[model samples]
Target: MLDSNKDIVLDELNKVFDTIDNSQVDQMVEMICGAKKVFFVGVGRVLLMLQAWEKRLNHLGIDAYYVGEINEPAITFDDILIVGSGSGESIFPLSIIKLAKKYGAQTIHIGSNSESSMKPYEDLFVRIPCQTKLYLKDEIHSDQIMSSLFEQSLLLLGDMVAMKIVQKKDIKDLHLLWKKHANLE
Candidate 1:
């Protein structure tokens, strides 16, 4: 029974990948590789995905941050704001994206629903087809992890982009930071 469920999930994911527009992926990579600063955000489980992206971007020498109340600064025209939303209709994150665009920043939206109205406002959209529990009033359940398999796929996508950034920039020392930061006994 578990295997059956797993197969179902894989099949759904395959469909999602099959339909994805490869050009959109190129747009995302191009934007990230060229952006001076990148800010990533998501409301709930999607936030976890964005957080991972932030770490990877930092490693690649890009300024990236997760949105919060710490007056984290705004994204500029040369900046890219990466947002992760399963539904793409989530209000808070959507609003943030809008504001970022208003400030002249390019936006990249990652979501499970490609048809979301939010896509119209973004410069790049990477859709991961999966049903997300739309909590009442556009809220997200903190307990629900937004389809583990799909989220994992998004993480892999982010990593791929990060690696691309490293290659495009021809980073001089990939492991130098690790060596300096490593806690040696």
Candidate 2:
């Protein structure tokens, strides 16, 4: 039963990724690479996934910080803000994305609904195309409860972006990333 459940989840993930737009992903990679710094915003499990992505970006020697972190720096025109909200209507993230835009920062929203309120504030929108709470039309149906599929896909997308960054920069030695890893840990 455990293995069967694993297969079901994996199949769902595969279907979700298969529907994602590669061009949007390419733009995300370009934006991340060009930014002076990257800031992330989200809530609940989405925020947790963003935190993991932030750490991975740091490990790749990129300046990445989450919005509410104590030491987070001021976001500027040169930086980019990445918001993860499957519904794209989350009040906090919507508010923050607007504020980031007000600061002249580039904003990218990764969510399931492209027509969401976040549309006006974000410079770019990357759709995950999975089942959201709103159950919008054409969302890929999921066996997993709630937004689990979306959250899991968000994490994998981050890693995919990280790997693309490595490829683009032509970092010959993967071991060199260790230099940026947390030393105290």
Candidate 3:
């Protein structure tokens, strides 16, 4: 029964990814690669996924940091901020994106609702097109509870971007990335 449930979840995830626009994803990759520094912001499980993405970007030798991390540098015109909020109406993320824009940094929002409050603040909107609290007309329905599908898709989207960076930069040795991994553990 657990196996069947797993399959169902995977199938749902597949549909979510399938519905995502590749052009938007490509634009996100370009922004990440072009930025002098990349910053991330989110809340709850969404923030957790952003944290993992920050780590992966670091592993790939990109300068990435989360909003609240210690010693985080000031965002500038050359930097970019990626905000993850499924509803696109999360209070904290919305505020952070506003601050990021105020700092002259480029802002990108990866969320389900394109018309959300984050819209005005963001320079780019990469819609995940998955189930969200708004119950938008275009969202892909999910069997998973709450915003689980959006969070899961957000994590995978980061990975997809990381892989694209690898290909675009022509990093021939995967071992080189291991050098960036935490060794203290």
Candidate 4:
């Protein structure tokens, strides 16, 4: 039983890697490099990943902000939205995507399925193929085994992007990233 579980975990990890789109990653990097501002959002576990990206982007000297945070302005045409939602059908993200697009903001969405609603609306979609919603035999809270798995991948992916930016742009000082770290009392 343990072996089977291990195999399943390994297979899921491999599936996440296989679906990675290097070209889209490059495009996202380019967009971040060129955009006047960058905004990101995610409903749950993915939201944590988005927040991490926002911090890294800020460290890289990009104007980065997280949605729903105080004082963050609406995304405009010169901005980009990076969102993570397993279903891509979440009403909050879909509505925000549409509103942002109306203002000409570009969207980059990472989700479980390629055919999700957000897929049609986004300028770019990074599909993380997995069963996003999971449930235990008697649990009420969504298990999100796949979503959690994808979150790990997204974290790695974001770090990779940050490193690439540092290399391409000659941002070698680790201090820059540290400086962006929030200092709350």
Which has the greatest TM-score? 2
> lDDT per residue, candidate 4, 1-185, as tens digits?
88887776666666667767788888888888888999888877778888988888887888988889997987889999888777777788888887788899999888766677776679988755555553222212222354567777778788988887887788767775776677883
In order of appearance, the predictions have TM-scores of 0.77, 0.98, 0.98, 0.82
By the lDDT metric, which is better: model 2 or model 4? 2
Off by over 4 Å in 3: none
Candidate number of the best lDDT: 2
Residue 118, model 2, lDDT: 95
lDDT of 3 by residue, 1-185 (tens): 99988997899998988888899989999999999999999999999999999999999988999999997999999999999998999899999999999999999999988899989888899989998988998899888889899999999998989999999889999998999999999
Whole-structure CA lDDT of model 3:
0.93
Tell me the tens digit of each residue's lDDT in model 2 across 44-157.
999999999999989888899999999999999999999999889999999999999999999999999989999999889999999999998889899898999999999999
Q: What are the runs in model 4 whose C-alpha is more than 4 Å off?
A: 1-11, 134-146, 183-185
Give per-model CA RMSD: 5.1, 0.7, 0.8, 5.0
Q: Name the lDDT value of residue 169 in candidate 1.
A: 80
Give the backbone clash total of model 3: 0
For model 2, what is the alpha-carbon lDDT of residue 57? 89
Of the two candidates 1 and 2, the one with more favorable lDDT, higher being better, is 2
Candidate 1 minimal-lDDT segment of 10 residues: 135-144
Residue clash pairs of candidate 2 = none
